[model samples]
Target: MATLVSILLLLAMWWLTMTTGALAISPGRVVATLTGGGTRIENLVIIDRRLSRLLAGSLIGFCLGTSGALTQTITRNPIATPDILGVSAGAGTFAVLALVRPETTERLLGVSTTVALVPVAILGGLITTGVILTLGWRGGFDGYRLVLVGLGINALALALTSWLLTRAEVEEASVAVRWLVGSLGGVRMGDVVYLAPMVVLAVLVCLRLAGGLGALRLGRDIGQALGVSAGRTEAGALITAVALVSVATAAAGPIAFVAFVAPQVAMRLFGTAGPPPLASGLVGALLLVGADFLAARLPLELPVGIVTSVLGAPVLLYLMTRHLRRTSV
Candidate 1:
């Protein structure tokens, strides 16, 4: 109920933000615009521009949140997330590469560069995840080892991204920087159209696997005893998480920490031991929309990822300190 209310409030804020800007419109006018009863300018600004951005931000948030919850559950670690596990970094690196070096990707993939971003990003994320899993596997998945490997891969991906940026032309490099920072400024309805269906499909798969994922928190042996195929369940969950993060990264350039922070925040709000995938997705949507709104309102408009990182950094520190203290004890 609280989550529902929070979502409603965020939706209201999102609508308000979309409707009002340089040329302000009232909430009533925004509603009328949505319902097809607004001036040409209002329609152009609200329907064409802001609505697309809002939808993109919301979907990206939902994907990240859902992916984050699944990742944390899979690893049995509160801080585990796609970003920390190098999935986002890998996706971002490949997407930027595709953007800056279109002909190379076009030649390799036998497709238009425009059509290759999501697929390349997904491939990168999957490959990175496979490496992390392989390096971390020791008879069974080890949380600490997985995190360590993921961090190393993340560093490597970042270095590669920096190198790629250096290779880009000045204009392409500027575009890459905005993408790296994660903004919705360039998003359009076409981008939303590409993102929404993938998110919906991934989300359906997540809902179907939610029960098995919940069982995973009890450990592999117990989960197997409960009739869950530990291996298959883990594989399915990881694939879904990778797909979710990949599409989200492809859409918004790897918005940082939404995946890491949203699930933890949802768990705290609901007072639950395990991350709730659906609720966490909603929380993520709210967080991103709110962050985008705040980012736009800043003296100089900032990337939504910058805002989320600012909010999430302190939370990350808190979680790390708590983890260290618990381990020390």
Candidate 2:
């Protein structure tokens, strides 16, 4: 019931946002446009422009939130998000490279730039995750070691991304900067079309694996004792997390801390001890759409990522402080 209400509120906000951009349309007009009754201009603006951006933002948020829940579940750590774990950084690095140096990626991958975006980003995220898992492995996953290695890798990826930006043409750099900051201003229907199927597939996989994931959360030995393949469950969760984060990053350029913040917020709202994957996804969509709306209304028209970062920083700090207190106790 709560989730349903939240979704309705978010949809309402999304509709209002679509109706009130540069060339404002009223709610009735926006509804008319959707129902094929508005002027051509209204139809174009509402359908082609605003709706695409809204869908992209919503899908990205849903993916990130669900991905974050999976990561935190598998790692048994509240802070184990794609951004903090370097998955987003890896995916973002490859995505930026694809944007700025399409020829290089094409030459190396023997695929056109358009065909390589999501796959290349996914590969980067998987490779980074593989490295983190390998380095952090001490017969099994260690949350602390995973975090340390991931942070290190994330730093390296960011540095490489910065260096690449420095080498790009001025115009390309400008475009890449907007993407890196997770802007939704220029998203089109094609992006939504490309991302929607992938998000759906990933969500289905997450649902299929949810039971195993829950069992694994009871600890490796206990899960194994209960006939769950701890290794398989962990691997599945990691791959799902990577796929979700990679696709979202490719679509929206990391989008800051949505993955990290959404699950926690959802857990709080639902008063659940474990991350609620579906609810988290909804919360994520809401957070992102709300952020995008605020960004559009802001005087400077900042990227949605900036808004999320500003909001998430305090939550991250509070989580860290709470984690510390728990450990000390």
Candidate 3:
């Protein structure tokens, strides 16, 4: 029932995106446009422009939310998101680097700019995850150690990103900055085509692994005794998360706390011991779609990331306060 409500809310929000934007198309017009009965202007506005933004926001949020659930569940930490774990930072770094220095990236990586920066971004995220997992697995990928190591690595990745930006041309830097902050603006159908299948498949993978993950929460030994391979499940979840973050970053930049906040909010709403992937994904899609709507309507115009950060910061602080109290007790 909660899941159904969440999905309905996502659809409601997405519907509002079409009907309530700057152009102020009516809901009826939007429906008509979809069914092929609207004006030329309505078709261009709804199909060419707004629909891409809607799909981009929805897809990015869903993937990030699912990734966050997997990461938090695997690490057993509510606050452990791809954003904090250096995956987003790493993916963003490489993607931004490619944007600002496409020639160099192509030269060094033997990748073509014609194909987009997805490969470089995925490579960067995988490399970063490989290092963090290797280090975090020194004895075990415990939540505390993973978060701490992730913080250090995340800082380094951001520093490198900053350096790359400073050396970029003004035009390139302007483009890079917008992408870095996460904008669903200028999304095209081609990008959506690339993103849709992967996001759907990845979320399905996360859902398929849910039973084992739920059991693994009891403890490794218990999970292992129950015929779950702790190592295999953890690896699969983390890898899925990395792929989701990498591809989404390549498509839409690192969109801030959708990954972190979505899962936590879903856990609260559903009363789960750990965040559940599909429900968390629905909430995430709602959050991002809603954030994009707000960003679009705001007086100054803003990247969607700013809205997410503003909304998610308070939650972060509240979680920190709770974490502190629990640890101190």
- Candidate lDDT (C-alpha), each: 0.87, 0.86, 0.86
Q: Least accurate stretch of 10 residues (summed lDDT) in model 1?
A: 13-22
Candidate order, TM-score descending: 1, 3, 2
Best by lDDT: 1
Model 2 Cα lDDT, one tens digit per residue, 1-329:
77878789788878788879789888888888898998989978899888888998888888889889888888888888889989899998988888888788889889987668789889889988988888888988777788898999999999999998999998878878888988777677777877788778877887888788778778878888989888888888788889888988887777888999999989888887778777888898899999999999888888888999999999999999998999999
TM-score of 3: 0.95
Which parts of model 1 have CA positions greater than 4 angstroms off? none
Instruction: Note the clash tally of each candidate.
Output: 0, 0, 0
Better of 1 and 3 by lDDT: 1
CA RMSD (A), model 3? 1.6
Model 2 segments more than 4 A misplaced: 107-115
| lDDT digits (tens) for residues 43-126 of candidate 1 | 999988888889988888889998999889888987779999898999899899998987788999999876798898999999
